[model samples]
Target: MDMKKMAGDKAAEYVKDGMVVGLGTGSTAYHMVNAIGERVKNGLKIQAIPTSKATEAQARELGIPLLTIDEVDHVDLDIDGVDEIDPQFNAIKGGGGALYREKVVATLAKEVIWIMDESKLVDHIGAFHLPVEIAQYGSKQAMARMEECGWKPVLRVRDGKTFVTDNGNYIADLHLGAGFDIEDVREKLGTIVGVLEHGLFLNMCKRMIVGTSSEGVRVIENPSK
Candidate 1:
């Protein structure tokens, strides 16, 4: 049933005309961006801010009008994908190395929606290694600090080279293991000098769209909404 596409397309339905939208990065977000592009072709009007260079290119190719973050006071909505989301709605993101920009966009949006397949939903979040973006200049020291705290930090690599994000930072995937304290870890990571942003998305999402092969698409509103 292509659950990723299902969830992504469903999230796109929330977009309306004359609004400013924050377009997210990742595989699931690809579908949402595509769906929105189709709408734009049919005369839907909205200004979009892409979370990464990859997304910006896609949005440009799709004829989606683009805006820089500095041009917008606030985004009406932001839809992105999560690597892992727990029952408490805490999520692990940045699997695509766009965590820093994604976090910034999400923070500027009035509403945020996360789209993912049912497999991403878990009883807890730590199973998926938390991604922390750090400045390249002192990345090694940052990783060393994380390792000292037992996070088991591993630098992300792609094509035999270190994976660099759109913000030109390095990503360290932290293996927190099971039953770890989310708040404590987040606090500790923030204390690191070179740490720019981490993948822990807490208390931000207003809704989540999950796609399932059996039941089709499910939209869950945040309890705090």
Candidate 2:
């Protein structure tokens, strides 16, 4: 079986009839979206709250009903993808630049699930540079501030232009090096002006469906969930 598909299908099994779901972004989540689309066609009634414009478009194309954050009381389940996940199940998401919205939807959901291949699981999260969403207005100042904090932030650019997120915010990919204290960085980033949200998702996921082409799929549970 395809690893991404295996992981995604594993997560789709958790979606019940008529559940209000939080749809996520990225490649692994893309597989889940397609799987959910198939379920929708077979008479599954689900309202999806998409975390990014790209995700919203995919879900819309798949005929999944979408709802704004204000439209629903709360999300029943959220299936997202992570950039990196640690032993404690703490994860770093926002690789698709949807950290702000993803975090919002995940928090509102009763159960949050992340789908990924085996490579995403890590001993620690710092290997992949973390994403920090920020306003474009004072991004230079923000980057300078991060540099002062020793994070070595870099602007995420696209086609010679600064990459822009669905929410019209800019992204700063922080290179914090190995053995860095993620919690301290999270706290410090929160205190910085112009910082909207970072990719460091601490204790948010209830379950992770990790897959590999050789091993099929397996589920890992977070104690908090």
Name the best candidate (by lDDT): 1
Clashing pairs in 2: none
Candidate 2 lDDT by residue in tens digits, 1-225 = 778888988898899988999999989999999999999999998889999889999999999999999898799999999999888888888878899999999889999998999999889888888999999999889999999998888999889999999889999999876557987998899899999999988888888999986667989888776
- Candidate 1's TM-score: 0.98
Best by TM-score: 1
CA lDDT, candidate 2, residue 78 = 96
lDDT of 1 by residue, 114-172 (tens): 99999999987888889999999988899999989998999999999999888888999
Candidate 1: C-alpha RMSD to true structure equals 0.8
